[model samples]
Target chain A: MKSKRILDALLAPMVAIIFSVVLASVILMLFGANPIETFSKMINYAATPRSISLILNSATTYYFSAVAVAIGFKMNLFNIGVNGQYRLATAVGALVAGALTFPGYISIPIVIFVSMLVGSLWAGIAAWLKVYRGVSEVISTIMLNFIAIGLIAYLLAPSMLGVQTAENVVGTPVIPESGRFPGFSIPGSQVPVYGMLFLAALLGFAYWFILNRTRFGFDLRSVGQSPSAAVASGVNVKRMTMYSMLLSGAVAGLVGLPLLLGAQYSFTVNFPGSYGFTGIAIALLGRNHPVGIAFGALLWAFLDVSSQILDLVGVPREIIVIMQGVIVLSVVIAYEITRRVKVRRQQDAVGKATAVAQ
Target chain B: MRRVIKIASVLFAGSLVLAACSSSDEAAVEENAAPVVKVGLAYDSGGRGDGTFNDAAAAGVDRAVAEFGVEVNEVEAADADGTPERAERLRLLASEGYNPVIAVGFAYSDALAEVAPEFPDTTFAIVDSVVDAPNVGSLIFAAEQGSFLVGTIAASASKSGKVGFIGGMEIDLIKAFQAGFEQGVKAVNPAATISVAYMGPAGDNSAWNAPDRAKTAVEGMIDKGVDIVYAAAGGSGLGMHQAIAAAGGSAKGYWGIGVDSDEYVLPARAEFKENIVTSMLKRVDTAVFDVIAGVVNGSPLTGIQNFDLSRGGVGYSSSNPVVSAFASVADGYAEKIKNGEITVSSTLTE
Candidate 1:
């Protein structure tokens, strides 16, 4: 039984990968592109030092975004507002940090604290609506995403928080040098690997530890499993929902810090948007597992980095996007099939034991 | 079971967003024999079919392809991908032997600055923004000079003595256009009230992409007795054109000034072309063609070569008949600008 569980775990992902590859190959041929050459080039690019650094940097942001969504997913909550939460948090965080001067330790933590506070507050509105007014989170969160974009659009203008930073660019003023993360070289790449990479990994560990080993985690998961039963067991399901939403928003606040601190040192009007949607995909891709999410973020990052090479090889770079969609769809289908198969085998094993005894 | 359905629905919505945003058409161009000079155009977030900035850049490359027979490989920058991804695009082009990699927009400033130093042998040129590298050639336009001509037309054609300027972003590049337009308006009519407003801050693509906002601003100005409206907004500039045409074109004495390419005759803007007065031609196509021509001719034009009015790199279109009435007045300023008699400053004094 133990070996079967292991096989099921490994087999599901492998099957998903093979299915996506076959589908992508057929599409590539229709576009007049050689699938073998395109895939080979992507693999080759992935092995490069520059590609390694780029993937790690992108993965850092993706991890924060994924974990934030995963927390909500565990409760069956569709926290589509991670984009809004992070943007609002980062913009406010940067604005506050840029407005003040402090040492590295003092200022960085304050910036992070402000980010979590703002992000939590942003998500709290949705939580309040869900618990009190019976508002569906999906609808409210989607609306909040637009509100967030409109808010950022207003805040980043010159009359408000914006300042001219480059020839044709305006952005928030630079954060204090000491307050910024001093990223280090990763050897073989001109671009330095973000120092926050370690933080993202630590976050993964903490998420695993807190969700698996703590009492609060127990009540949270129990409510997630069956809210009515948990309510009967003396768990305040409403409180648990509120707590998880806050925690998820807190995590979401850190999504932009890697790039904000490690590279740019300020929030430009062109501050990379759309990671919140990518997080949803990663959360689904990882199946809400800590280790699984780490691999998922890396794969998504890999696809982004590898696609750049496709254009150089005279192939449609969008082939990577197609492959990603296919992989995601297949994984969902593959996992469901595996779950049914495992259940049937367990019932069969129990039936044989009873028949022998009779 | 419900969870499965919910997940499927979310995936469907996500794919729809992807389909709407992705520009995957017009894939790869295969050239059998290696051409003498290979040009790789790294388009900004707008990509190929954006019908605004990237399309204008492609026009120059297309002309180069026909005349120089140079092989071209095109790559587009994805939205919100950050600077590293942009640098990677340039590096990929350079390492793969693309000689003169042309970055289409000012947003590529930081990315090109990083990658140009790594490939010292590769010749890189960026439009609109200046990158300080030995091999980098900044193809800047005297936008202020071109804008001055439109300002003249806007003032001469305006019977209400009210004009408006809508800038795409609050950046210096667009500001130059604003400054020239205001100066031209002031130069012609001292009593003219020129209201200026920007869509958003610089580096925000939405500043150029938000047509609804531009339309709203234009409507407000028109309600305030403004007869002429000029928009330097990028893709969404069409919305302002639409608003003007709907408000009653030449028949109602409403005139809209077009920017970048001559929008008077563009098929996309043809629906409202009759409403368009002379468009402020920045001549990006001419500059792009010249850079490519230099490479093929073995005399690559380097350094800060300002394509100004003297060389005919900047001017206005007289495609509309209404513009003919003010042609003599606009041409007088054009000659003055070309002869340095009427010096236009890129920076706005007021």
Candidate 2:
């Protein structure tokens, strides 16, 4: 039974992968593109030291985003507002960081703390609406996303949160060097891997430890599995929901920090947006497992970096997007089928055992 | 599950045969002797079909393909991707043996800086932003010069003695447009009240594409007695024109100035055809074509190539009949501008 479960676990993803490859190959052929050549070029480009570092940096951001969504998922909550939470947090965080002149340790933590506080504050609103106002979190969070964007749009104007940079590109004033994260070179490449990669790792470890080993985590999961039962069993369901939602939002707030402090140093108009939606997909693919999420983020990042080479090879880079979508869809279907098969097999074994005893 | 796999494999086998059949067309292209020069165009977030800046770049490449027979590959930046993606696109172009890789946006400045050093032999041309690299060609336009001409038209055409300048973002590039427009309006009618407002801040590129916001800004200006509105806000200009058309329109003497390409005859802006007085012609197409020509002719264009009015790189579109009334006044300014007699400031004073 144990071996069968293990086989099911490995087989589902493998089948999905193979199916997606075949489907993608057929689509490429229909488009008159040589999929073999196109894929080989992508693999070759991604194999480079510089490209590997790029992938890792992208994966780090994706990993954090996935973990943030995973926290909400564990509670059966869909916090779509991660998009707005992170943007608002980063904007406020950048402003706070820019005003301070503290040392690296003091300022970085303050910036990160402010970011988490703001993110939690925003997410807390959705939780409050859900618990008290009886508003669906999905709707409230999505609406909040737009509200967040609107708020930033209003605030980031020159008279508000912005200062004009060179060539009319207005952004937040650069943070002091003391507050900025120091990036280090990846072995042989000039490209500096984001120092906050360590932060992502640390967060991933925390996510695993807290969710698996803590009492609060138990209440959160109990409510998620069965809210009515948990309520009868003395779990504060509403409080658990609020806690998990706030925790998710706090993590969501850190999504942009690595890029903000490490590369941009200020929140420019182009402070990377839309990681929240991508996070949903990564979380779904990872099935809320920390290690699974890390792999999922890497795979997503790999596809993004690799597909860039498709444009060079005279193939549409959008093929990669299609492939990614197919992989996600097929994997989901494959997992569902495997789960049903495992359940059926377990019932069959029990039936046979009962018949033999009779 | 077995049956599903069997059907999928069979379908896959059928597609393989069909795919093999389709490969013949591409095979024929591969058989051709390699072209002398290969140009790769890396478009900004708004790639082709934008009917504006990117379309203008595409037009230049199309012309190059027809006239010079140079092979061209075009890549667009995804909306959600950032600087690293831009750099990766450029690197991909360079690695694939594309020469004179032209980046269509100012956002490519950082990307070009990173990629240019790694591939020193490759020639990179970036529109809008200047990078100090030996191999980089900065194809910057004197949009202020063009904006000045449109501003002159707005001053002449306005009945309310007030005009409006709706910029996409409060960035320096867009400010250049505002400065020129404001100066031109002031130059013609010193007492004219020119109300200026930006659609949004610099961080969001959607500011340039947001029609609703542009329309709202235009409506606000019109309410305040501004009869003439000039939109230098990329795709957002369409909304401004639409707003002007909704408010009594061109036949009723309300006017809008278009930007980038001549929008007077563009099918997309056909409904607001009469309302468009004249477009500020920032000839990105001419500049792109010229650069490709230079490359093919062995000059291999490098450094800053400023497109000003004297070289026909920037000017007022003469497509509209209403513009004929101000032709003489506009001509005087154009001649003076070309002759270096009247120096137009690109900076916003005040």
Candidate 3:
């Protein structure tokens, strides 16, 4: 039973991936390309060290976003505001850090603290509305996303935090060199692998350790499983909800750090939107497990990187778009089918054990 | 690994091309020296089909294809990953031996900065921004120079002194348009109030894509008794044209000045042709084609190559019948700018 439980966990994602590939193959066939040859070409393309490096860099970013979403998912609190939270956090973080030239030891910590604080406070608004005003967090968070956009827009004005450093760019001033984390470079790529890669790994381990080995995590999970049961067990449901939200938002704050510190050195106008929403899809794909989320991120990154080769091959980019959509849909579908079968199998086992006792 | 994939895909795609043509090159043995110039263009936010600057850049590639017979691979940027994705696109093109790759917008500045150093052998050209790399060429236009002419036309065509400027984002490039337009509006009428508003803030791609927001902004501008609107808002400028056309157009004394290529003639803007008084023409296609042509002739334009009024790289389009009445007046200012007698400020005073 233990081996079978593990098998089901592993087999589900595998089956979904295979299903997605088959669907993609049919689409490729319609496009007049041999799916096997195309996919094999992509596999060859992915083998390069440069491609691997880029995949890791992309996965590093996705991991932060997915983990942030997963935290709220684990608590049954849908904090859809992760996108707004991260964006606002980085904007404020960049504004402050961009203005001040301090030692790395001081400035780095300042950036991290400022980002988490702003992210936490922004998310706390929705939590506050939910707890006191009886407003649904879903509606509140979505609205806040737009509001956050407006707020960032205002801040990005030249009269405020914005400084035009290039022809078409208006962004916060560059972070002082002393404050930046000089990341290591990989072979065969000019772009440095982000120093935040180590930080993401640390975040993953901490997520696992805290959720499985800590008291707060247990209460949080209990509240997620059943509010009535948790209320009977002395868990403060509202407080737990607030805690989960704040924590999720804090993690979301780290999403932009990889780009900010590693590559661009500042948050510009095109700092990449929609990362927060992609996190939701990734978390679902990974089943919210830390390790699972890591693999899901890498796989998604792999698909993105391969699209470059696929672009060169003259395939319609929409075919890759379809494959991505299909994979996410299959993850959800396969998860449901396996979950039902598992529940029935457990029920059968319990019934047989009772019959043997009788 | 990448070389292997590129070669394999080329062969594979080549076979398909041969199959489709029916009578073309099945006698293929030119693998040693294909002799064709392969041009790679990576377009910015609006991509190829936006019918704005991107489409103008596409026109440049189309011209290069027609005149020089260069093989082209066009890649469009998705806004999701910003810098890294852009860098990867350039890297892919350069590594695949696309000798002279072109990035369509100023947004490619940072991406080119990173990728240019890596592919020292590949010549790169980016429009609207400069990167100080040995192998990279910067094709910058005097947009403000062009905008100044349109601004004079807007003031000349307007029944009311109140004019408006709508930018996609509050960035330096778009701001220069605002600056030049303001000067020209002031050049005509010093006391004229030029209402300036942008669709969104900088750093987000949606600023260029937000037509609804632009439409609302222009509606607000029209309500303020403004008679003419000039927009450098890329795809979102279509919203401005739509609004101006809907709000009584030239019949009600409302006009919109276009940007990049002539908006009056673009199929996408045909319905709004009556609304477009004139366009501030920035010949992006000419710049793109020039870069490709230079590479073909082995004199790749390197460093800050300014395309200005003197070079006829920037001008005012007299496509609308309304602009014909004001054409010579606008052209006089264009001549002065071309001679440096009338210098336009690229910086906004307000």
Q: Which candidate leads in lDDT?
A: 1
Task: Judging by TM-score against the true structure, name the best candidate.
Answer: 3
The CAPRI quality class of candidate 1 comes to acceptable
Looking at model 3, the pairs that clash are A269-B203, A270-B203
lDDT of 3 by residue, B102-199 (tens): 99887788888989998887889999988999998899999899989888888887777899999987778888999999999889888788888897
CAPRI tier for the interface of model 3: acceptable
Q: Rank the candidates by TM-score, best first.
A: 3, 1, 2
- Across A174-275, the per-residue lDDT of candidate 2 in tens digits comes to 788998988788786667788999999899999998888998888887877788888999999889889988999999999988878877777766667788
Per-residue alpha-carbon lDDT of model 1 for B204-288, expressed as tens digits? 5567787889888989998999989999988768778877877887789998998888888776688888888878988778888
Clash totals, every prediction: 0, 3, 2
Please report, as a residue range, the 10-residue window in candidate 1 chain B with the lowest summed lDDT: B1-10
DockQ of 3: 0.24
Q: Which ten residues in a row have the lowest lDDT in candidate 2 chain A?
A: A163-172
How would you order the candidates by DockQ, starting with the best? 1, 3, 2
Which residues of candidate 2, in runs, are more than 4 Å off?
Answer: A10-12, A95-107, A150-165, A175-188, A333-358, B1-34, B64-68, B155-166, B182-200, B211-229, B240-256, B265-276, B293-305, B336-350
TM-score of each: 0.87, 0.84, 0.90
Clashing pairs in 1: none
Winner on lDDT (1 vs 3): 1
